[model samples]
Target: MPVEQAESLLASQFSIQHTYYRQHYPHGRFDIIMQGTKNIGRLYHDWSGDVVQLIDIALLSAYRGAGIGTRLMRAIVTEAARKHMRMQLYVEFDNPVRALYRTLGFAPAGENGIYELMHRDAMPFDEEAWASVRGLNNPFQ
Candidate 1:
């Protein structure tokens, strides 16, 4: 895709996502992912239902694989454990983060078109491991 088209497509996709979130999670909040003062990504989720659905989680290409994503996932998992809810998300099949989700105990739930639904059941939170990530201060304690 050309640079201009790619940017437009991304903007359009996010617009659609916002609309969907408004319809499904009227009170949901959008979170900006930041590294120090630098904005790095966005996270959109809803915990209104029995399951905490992760609608979107995106980090800039430069920040991928630096353990930031893992920390966020751990925080979600920890929260789910506290609330007795399952955590779920749909990930594109081509996305490498699928392995990270799997390693974190999410399993294949189903698939639709190019995306696979994955789910992790609530369990004990791993505070110690989450504390070990360099940039992530422990959120569980």
Candidate 2:
């Protein structure tokens, strides 16, 4: 196939998938991750159920490994803890971000094909930790 045609086909497929997700998870949120004025990545999640589900999160190659993902995950963990809600997400078996999720207290709950489901029970809120992760006194800020 011509390069242009292949690109168009892929783009349309992605659009279809995105639309399907939106319709399936009507309460899900999709946020663009930004740094200053540049778009760095995206975060998609749903908190409408008993469990806070982190559907997807990605950072640009230039923005990875800089603790941005850690901070974001921490924030979500803190909020879920505050609400006493369990958290869950699916990570590809080979995705390095699984380590970060493990560090944030998520453990392998199950598996489906190439994706491993990670779960973290609701935790007690810790103000100091939340503050630090939020850059209150954290160097990453």
Candidate 3:
């Protein structure tokens, strides 16, 4: 989706307030969606790279620990491999969800206070793949 269209949808879906929007990101926004309408969810992000972001993954109030989060993550992982893009997201160091991301193969690439920049690609991108992956990774390449 175009940046304008995505922000338009998330403006309501994410209940984004104008103040927060202007203060935090004066430049851009994102595209949000869920998994297959199975209640499993996914958010697509293009922050200089292609990634499927996880957001507001909700389980019924009574379904807190029947492995829902894990299942949803795995689904995203499977899809990611085919798309040939990685999964990226932020999680506070103490967030229980951080453990889950580790389980699904994400590693800390950078940080923001208590949060981390995490990503997963079965094969950590090589010189070529990395160049195409997100356009960063030059680490003197």
Top of the candidates by TM-score:
2
Clashes of 1: 0
Q: Which is the better candidate, 1 or 3, if ranked by TM-score? A: 1
For all the candidates, what are their Cα RMSDs to the real structure?
A: 3.0, 4.3, 11.4
lDDT of 3 by residue, 74-98 (tens): 6556556656777777777887877
Better lDDT candidate (2, 3): 2
Q: Per-residue lDDT for 28-139 in model 1, tens only?
A: 6688777777788888888778888888888899998888888888777867877888888999999988998898789999999999999998777776655455564333
- What is the TM-score (0 to 1) of candidate 1? 0.80
Model 3: lDDT of residue 99: 86
Roughly what TM-score does model 3 have, to 2 decimal places? 0.53
TM-score of 2: 0.81
Candidate 1 stretches greater than 4 Å from native: 1-10, 130-141
Against the unseen true structure, what C-alpha lDDT does each candidate score? 0.81, 0.81, 0.54
